[model samples]
Target: MKLKTALPYVLLLLPLAAFAAPGSQSGEIRFTGQIVNSGCAVARVGALSAAQSRQVEIKPGLKVEVDTDRNACGHQSLPISMSYEALKTSTDKGIVTITYL
Candidate 1:
């Protein structure tokens, strides 16, 4: 394909590339604390629900967007790396219990 023809596809991939970068994916937050702190750890003050779940590698100082259960709040940034296994357990109704090591 000509460079001009391929340009569109390349441009479309920029955003995808950004997300794939380590800097973008560095925000894997695993909440490890009391059930009471699940709010702050996950960083949601109120009850939050996860319609869908995923396994991710969380890094330090990265902000995780509260994809689901955002009805309660927005930008509940998690400053920790939540484990892939523990996050799965915390996505239920009421309190979400979690831990990190």
Candidate 2:
């Protein structure tokens, strides 16, 4: 009779015993990150004077020069080289391509 009465209680406590077992522990998960400034600024200059408001014609094979400023970038920024190519689309539109060297 006693065995039958205690059997139900033992079955109910089995799951609780697993969670309270020896060497059981709880810990917190930690995460860390940082934000940094990067990248340079580029400016384009056309051959036309500032006072001239007319549209300037650019030849297909002409080479355009651009100036880059790195003063705004952080000192930790590394030196890098780049190349640019010009491609003409089927619709007679111009596309500029940039490559990192």
Q: Using TM-score as the measure, which candidate wins? A: 2
Error of 1 at 95 (Å): 33
Rate residue 24 of model 2 by lDDT: 31
Give lDDT tens digits, candidate 1, residues 8-101. 9999999999988866447786678655333322534233346532233343423233432332222453333454333544643233334432
Instruction: Give residue 42's error in model 1 in angstroms.
Output: 26
Task: Say which candidate scores most in lDDT.
Answer: 1
What's each prediction's clash count?
A: 7, 0
**Model 2: per-residue Cα lDDT at residue 97:** 43
Q: How close is every model to the real structure, measured as TM-score?
A: 0.25, 0.26
lDDT of 1: 0.45
lDDT, candidates in the order shown? 0.45, 0.44
Put down candidate 2 lDDT per residue, 7-97, tens digits, no spaces. Answer: 9999999989997886534665557875343334322346423332222123544344322333322244323333343445455445444
Off by over 4 Å in 1: 24-29, 32-101
Q: What is the C-alpha RMSD of each candidate to the true structure, in Å?
A: 18.5, 12.9
- Stretches off by above 4 angstroms in model 2 are 1-32, 46-78, 90-101
